[model samples]
Target: MKFDLTEERQMLQDSLRRFLGDRYTTARRNEIIDSETGMSAEIWSQLAELGVIGAMFTEDQGGFGGAGFDIAVVFEELGRAGVVEPFLDSALIGGRLLAEAGQGEKVEKVMEGALHLALAHGEPGSRYDLNHVETTARDGVLTGRKAVVMNAETADLMIVSARVSGDVADQDGIALYLVDKGTDGLTIQGYPLLAGGRAAEVTLDHVRGTELFGADKGYQALADVTALATVAQCAEALGAMETATALTKDYLMTRRQFGRPIGTFQALAFRMSDLLIEMEQARSAVINAAGYFDTDQRDLYVSGTKNLMGRAGRLVAEEAIQLHGGIAMTQEYELAHIAKRIVMADHRFGDTDYHLERFIDLSAA
Candidate 1:
């Protein structure tokens, strides 16, 4: 299958790369991550103005491109820059969920960057199970805890998952609610993550929420959204791996020992070659996942892609750091952040082991 992007997507990629290259320097990203919100409002607004957020949705949802490839393209660029923006949370996952629930106005607000959203789905000990929701919603009130909610601290709105009926791990009777920030009985404990981002521990006790797309029905949508996020993360890891490999190559060529560049040694050169091979395989997996998204077998492909990316990302990050010596471990260098992001991307949505198990389960079915 042809993986070439259309003209529109190509232009979008070029424009976004140029913009990020000009503005999103390592120092600037550090400042953003160190800020109170752990993000740059100005950069978010600029992304919106460039139609970056809008591109993640379909035309029906007021976006020009909403295909899996669109999401992959945007996220890959973001990953290459090591950007800390919340596009995956706000636009790809939360906005798409609202759009699927027929909340067009809310999606539009999110596309405009006037609203920020977090999905409060993961719970303590949920362990990558989308259906393992201990949070309960009854009588339009939510009561329970959500752990490690990304962007919840600064989000203007939150999409929460709760069980309205049935057991905690049952797929049926899973529901979603729309809760505004600062609501009574809603508490958010914000903290920084080791991966250079922020997350919150959200607790709700008798906090009222408006049902999204009716009550006690959203498990399928949640599953689909999670798969989409997983695919986007695969793309992001591919980008980071690409950067890491290139940096390692450059370092080997310039850094010399015994009156010769280290790259001249067969051992180091062979390792670099192996890294390139892994990167290529990871790229192919990402492309396959993007193509399969929106199809009946999307979940299967997503799981496979994420598993491959996780392995590839870990290999690339470790080798890049080792090959570059101690300099790659320091925060002052760009490769250090890129490598860290690549490694951490594997843990989101689901880790390598999680996706491998899921892939086997889906294949058996």
Candidate 2:
């Protein structure tokens, strides 16, 4: 249980931190978020060139490191920097979905940052269930609306889920289709997420898409890919918690209250200690999930880790803002965005409630 990065992973971590630290500053991030795609094309290209995207996959998928720890390493850095990039969607989730569907060349392009992909799985009222697809695909044509698909606007291609047969909630009837951007009968209405990304409400009216995966196999692949994305997101939240805690600690020491720094107050000091402990616990959960990511125990660990991270993220967000008082609420300050991102991260994939139930069910089984 000595959860330390290997020599190569350490190098990768060091390089990513340095690169993001230098370029993705608060001001620059704001610019990117306000951009049309909610991401920076220049930064995306640079990251791909630096092999940051490639590091998340295996050699067969055209990446050097596709381990669970590799995913944790990459996303933790992304969280630390508060980057708004679509790496999570395009590179991690969509890229792997393509590969799992036997589309290696597309994954290669995704790793290269030349192509972007979105997984259009969640539909209206799906509420995080992988098999709750109501969209239909017949004769290679799709019909139905997908709600809140991440990175949809930037994706050159999207893997949409549909039901070719059986009832909507039945797990066996699920299928996946590959739809290109600007395809006929495909309409996307995208908006910024509360965190730092873009999502779209997609409507397909008899749109034809290539079948990447069919009934009986699509659900499991979606589950596995979503599980991996969950791990990456939890790691990202851990990184954000680290940044928020550090910012609070620094503020405590420097900000004056009465005759001395507010950190001297015993009550404030205790709260800060609690925040640190919660953060460490969150880190442990992320490490555990990432370690078990490729194993049979992935579901158990992922659910438990996500549930912990969600609660911990809320705690850190609230405590950090309270510790900073009025300054933290200001849009110009760093903590404002970080705090928001932490809370919003909880709601993505599954929130605290969803993961807690998932953990209970999986444990019983």
TM of each candidate vs. truth: 0.98, 0.98
Write candidate 2's Cα lDDT for 220-298 as tens digits: 9888888899999998888888899999999999999798999999999999999999988998999899888778899
lDDT of all the models against the reference?
0.89, 0.90
- lDDT at 354 for candidate 1? 95
Worst 10-residue lDDT window for candidate 2 reads: 99-108
| Structure candidate 1, residue pairs in collision | none
lDDT of 1 by residue, 1-365 (tens): 57689999999889999999899988888888888888899999999999889889999888899899999898888888888888888778899999889899888899899989999999997978888989898978999999999999888999998889889889998889999999999999999877677999999999999988444458888988888888878888888788899899999999999899999999999999999999889988988898989798998999999999989899999999999999898988889889989999977898999999999999999
